[model samples]
Target: MAVLRTLLGQALRTTRLSQERTLREVSSAARVSLGYLSEVERGQKEASSELLASICRALGVRLSDVLRDVSETLSVIEPEPAPVLVPVAVPAMAGPGTTAAELRSVRRPVRDVVAAA
Candidate 1:
């Protein structure tokens, strides 16, 4: 399974590097120790929500944007789920056009809702 912290760390590191900023600069701006920030970037340590916000602020990026990027990365790496068949009660139709066999359940993938997001 893919680790969330690793993805988060990668996204943060990518953002910082794209902006041409050093770890020292971000750590200093975030008021966190340089070693800790480095560890977080390397996926060696988990950062708290507050620390993540601070790091985002230091990097001049939004937390939501970072998370969205991580989510997209995860979707690409994660395996697709099997389709599920759900039974549905079909209402009776009073017309001659009613088809009994066509009122069966539908097969849908589990991640449809997630993919829409």
Candidate 2:
């Protein structure tokens, strides 16, 4: 199926194979059902953040690492090239007293240019 080659599916398969691990081991370590985890690894189901984290922990890897591998694989996957973004350290603005309003998005102005005849 088309789903098998997707980034998420590829990442799951890569991770599983890289460690020479089995679905049963991941399921037991992640505290999920073997059947359900199998579906997720095959990209047949969308996994939640919590479930993903559990699986990542079970594999002795970070969620970010998995995401990075998935993204790198995704970048070279398609015909069209995408913009490359460098990860930089962003200072956290929210901590103990951050407000919801501070987290809201604000629209930016759009510019249109007219051709002079």
**Index of the highest-TM-score prediction:** 1
Q: Which ten residues in a row have the lowest lDDT in candidate 2?
A: 108-117
lDDT tens digits, residue span 8-83, model 2: 7568767888999998998899999999888887788888889989988998989899888777766675456444
Q: Candidate 2 versus the native: TM-score?
A: 0.60
Tens digits of per-residue lDDT, candidate 1, 14-116, equal 9999999999999999999999999998899999999999999999999999999999999999997767655444555525776656654332344563474
Clashes of 2: 0
Candidate 1 error regions (>4 Å):
82-117
Give the count of colliding residue pairs in each prediction: 0, 0
lDDT (0 to 1) per candidate: 0.85, 0.71
